[model samples]
Target: MPIPSRPRAAALAVSAALLSTSLAACGGDSKDDVDLPSQTLSWKDCPAPSESEGGGEPPSPLPGGTEWQCATMKAPLDWDDPKGDTIDIALIRAEASGAEDKRIGSLIFNFGGPGGSGVTTLPAFGTDYAKLRTRYDLVSFDPRGVGRSAGVECEDAEQLDKYFQQDSTPDDEAERQKLVDNVSAFNGNCEKHSGKVLPHVRTTDAARDMDLMRQVLGDDKLHYFGISYGTELGGVYAHLFPKKVGRAVFDGVVDPTEDPEQGSLGQAKGFQLALDNYAKDCTSQVEDCPVGDTPQDVKDKIAKLLRDLDEKPIPGIFPRDLTQTAATNGIAQSLYSKDFWEYLTEGLQQAYDGDGKVLMMLSDSMNGRNEDGQYSNIQAANVAINCADDKPRYTPQDVEEKLPEFRAASPLFGDYLAWGMLGCTDWAVGGAADHPDVSATGSAPILVVGNTGDPATPYEGARKMAQALGSGVGVELTYKGQGHGAYDSGNKCVSEAVNRYLLEGTVPKEGTVCS
Candidate 1:
C-alpha cells in the first residue's frame, strides 16, 4: 500500500486528518496592489520547519558554502477567480553556484506527494541535486493544501494513530461498513476543519501556480524537474503552457491517459513487479538469503506472514502492534528503494520470530510519523489533491466487483490497493476530470525518464506520458534500473544523460536507453 509520493508512502495515498488554517479568503475586487506575478519574494534564512512540515532543523548550506534561502510566494486561492483569496506557498532555494553568465535561471522541483513539503525535502536531498544547482538555482515549494501552504487538516494526530491501526481491508460486510464509516469520518473531519481550501487543491491549480512562479522568478521559460506525482504536474503544466516550457524532465512518470481505477490497477501491477524483483534479487544473492531459499518461497512466506498477522497482531512500537495493514504498508515502503530491501528482509525475519518493531517503523515512515509519535500532513494533502484531481468516486461495491482483477494483478498488494480506490468516496469537492490532459503538441522536447523497476509509477507509464505529450514534444529516455526514480538511483549512464539534457540543453536521443 503506497502513494504517488515519489516513494515510501502508503497505499493509494489513503488517510488524512484534522488541522486548521488561517488563510484569508478575499474577493476578486481588492485594493491589494501586489499580486502573485508581481509580488517580490523577501528571501531570508530558513527557520526550522513547522510541525505540519514534518518538523526538522533548518537545512544546512551546500558543500561550497551556499546557504539555502527561504521565501513565500502568494498565489490566488482559487485560480478560476484570479483576484480572490490567496495562500502562502512556502519556497526554498540554493542560488546557482556557477558564474552569472553560465547560469540558466531557476530549476523548480516538485518531488511528488502532491503532499511532500518541498521546502523540507529539497534540503534533505540537497546534495543529490547540487550538481544541477551549479548552473541553476534549485527551488521547490509546498503546493496548496500541502505542508505550510494552508495545509488541509482532518483528524488529529491521536485519531490518525488509531486510524492507521484499524483494519483497512475489510473481510466481511460488517467490516466493510465499518471501513466506509471510518473513511466518511475522515473526509467529514477534513471538511469540518479545512473546507474552504478543499475545493481548490486540484492539480490544475498547482500547475497555474507554477506558471506564476516562473514569471515572478523572471524566467521566460519554466525550467523544471519533476519526480513521481511531480511528473503528472509537469505534464499538466506543459499542456497548459506549451510555449513557456523549457529543460523539463519527468522521472517515474505517471500515465496521463488512465482514469482513477485504471491508475490504481496499474500501480497494483507495478508494486507486484517490484515485489517479484525483490524476491528474485534476495534469493539469487551469493550468500544464503536470510528470508527464504527461493523467490517463490520468499513471496509465499510473506503472504503467510500477512495472513497470520490478520489473525493475531504482533508487538510493534511500544503500545502498538503490527497488524496486517501496517505490515503490507511497511513492505511496500521498503520496495520504493532497493537500498531498503535489506531492511525488509530484516523486518520479515524478525516478524517470523514475533518481533514487529522494524516493520511498524517502516509503516510509520510511510505514514509520515516522526520518532516523537506525531504525524505530518503528507497523507492528508495527498488525499486532498488526489481526490480533487480524480473525478471518479468509488463505492465498496465497485471495489468488490474489481477485487478479482486487482488480486490477479498483485496477489500480495491487490486487496490493499483495490480498497484504496475509495479514498475519495463522498469527498467534499468535485474533481476536475477523469484524467489529466497532457497533450502539449507545440512544447519543446521534454525528456521523460522511465525506470523499468519503478513501483509506485510503473515502467509503462513513461511511454504513455511521452505518447500523450504528442510527437516531438516528448523525448523518451529509458533507465533500466530499480527503485522509484531513475536519476536518484546513482546510475552513471542515467545521470550523465539527464545532466547533458538539463545542463547542456542536449536532449538524449528519443529512445536512448541507460542501465
Candidate 2:
C-alpha cells in the first residue's frame, strides 16, 4: 500500500506576536552559541527485513544491485539543553549512481507523519526518483520521535485495538464521556511510557536536527523534499536557515497560518471534496458500483452504513468486530488515493454482505497494524508530535458550538475529525510550542506542489504556503490531478517539472499547472 501523508492538524497560522521571538531563537546558531560537531557518516549495508519485521513488504531489489547505506547520527534529546542527553537518529542513503563529476549534493527526504519513517518510505520511491537519483545522493532519516529513531510508544497492540474501537462520534453524555476517558487514558499512557521525549518532538526540534544532519553530511546548504507533515518541517527549516535553504520542495503543503480549529475545518472540507470526487468516479466508471447512481445517493448509503455499524458492530475475520470507528477509518483510507477506490468498492460491498473482513483489513493497514496483531508506533508518534507542536484550545463545549460548522464542511467526516482534537486538550507532557509564520525571506526559491483534488493538506493550503514564503522565494506548482502528493503519482508533467527543479535548480514559473 502507498503510504498516505498524514495531516498535521493543529494551528491554521502561527501567532504573529510570537513570531519575532521564536525566529530569533531558532535562527541559525549565532557565533556565541555552542558550535555543532561535525562527524563522518559510516555508511553500511542496509538491512533487508521481512514484512513482519516492520519493513513492510520487502522492496523490490535495488536497480543494478545498488544497495543502500545505513548510518546513525547523534542529536541532543532537547535542543534547548544541548549537553543534557542525546538520541540516535537513524539515516539511510543511496549514493548517486551517475557520474560523480556531474553529481549534485544530497537530496534529503521526509515522508510526512510527523511520525512516518523516511527509512521505509524513501527506498520505495527509488524507481520514481530515478531521474534525480542520478545526480544526487538520496538521504532519508527517521525524525526524533519516529521509527528506527527514539519513538513514542503509548500502547501495545491490544490496548490500541480497544482505543481504535471507541466511538469517535458520541451520541450522548455517557458516550461522550467514554470518548473523553479513552482519550485521557491514551494521553496518560503516552506520558508514562514516552514522557521524556514527548515534550521534545515538536517540528521545530526536528528542524534543528535536520540542520545538524546537513552540517554532518558536509553540505553547505540543505536540499530537501518534504511531503504533507514533512512540509511543516521544511517550512520551519526554511525559516530557521533562510540562507541555507537550497532547492527545497514542499509537496502537499500544509498552511501554517490557520489555527487548530481552522485547520480541522479545512481538512474536513478537503476530505469531503475527495469523497465527492471518488463517488462521482466510482458511480461513473465502475460497472458494479456498490453505493448508488449519484454522488448524493452514494454518500447517503455510506452514511447509513456507518450509522448501522454504530448501532451494531459486525464480526470480521479478526477476533474483534468492525465498529463504526474501524469502518470509518477504512473509508477514509480509501480516500487518500484513487488507486484504492476499487478496494473501497470491494470493502463496502463486503460490508453490505455482512462480512467486514475487507474493511477491517483496510482499517488495520491505515493504523499500521500487522496481521500478527502487532501495531507500529506511527499513531503514538503522530499524536505526540501534533499535540506538542500546537496545543489544543477547544474545550468540549467549544467543539459543540463549532459542530455545525464542521458538519457543514464535511457531513460525512466532520464530527470525528473535529472531535479528534479532544486528545490534545490536556496533553500530559507537551504543550503548544511557538509555530512562527514562515516567510523564508532571502531564501533560495522553494517549490510548493499542490494537488487540486488532494484529500489531505488540501490544494489551497499549498497556495497559501507559497504566498507565505514570499513572492520571490516560493513557487507554486499545481497538479490538477487526484491523490495526495503529485510527483510520484505517474503524472509526467509534474514529474518532469519537479525533476527539472531538483536536478538543475530551475524553479517552475509561478502559476504553472499540470493536469
State which candidate has the highest TM-score: 1
lDDT for 493 (candidate 1): 87
Off by over 4 Å in 1: 7-37
Among the numbered candidates, top lDDT falls to 1
- Looking at model 1, residue 252 earns an lDDT score of 82
Residues 379-446, model 2: lDDT tens digits: 78888888888755557788798899999999988897878768685587645643545778889999
lDDT of 1 by residue, 306-334 (tens): 99999999999889999999999988888
- Model 1 earns a TM-score of 0.94
User: Residue 279 in candidate 2 has what lDDT?
Assistant: 88
* lDDT per model vs. reference: 0.85, 0.77
Name model 2 segments beyond 4 Å from true.
1-33, 48-60, 286-288, 433-436
User: What TM-score do all the candidates reach, one by one?
Assistant: 0.94, 0.92
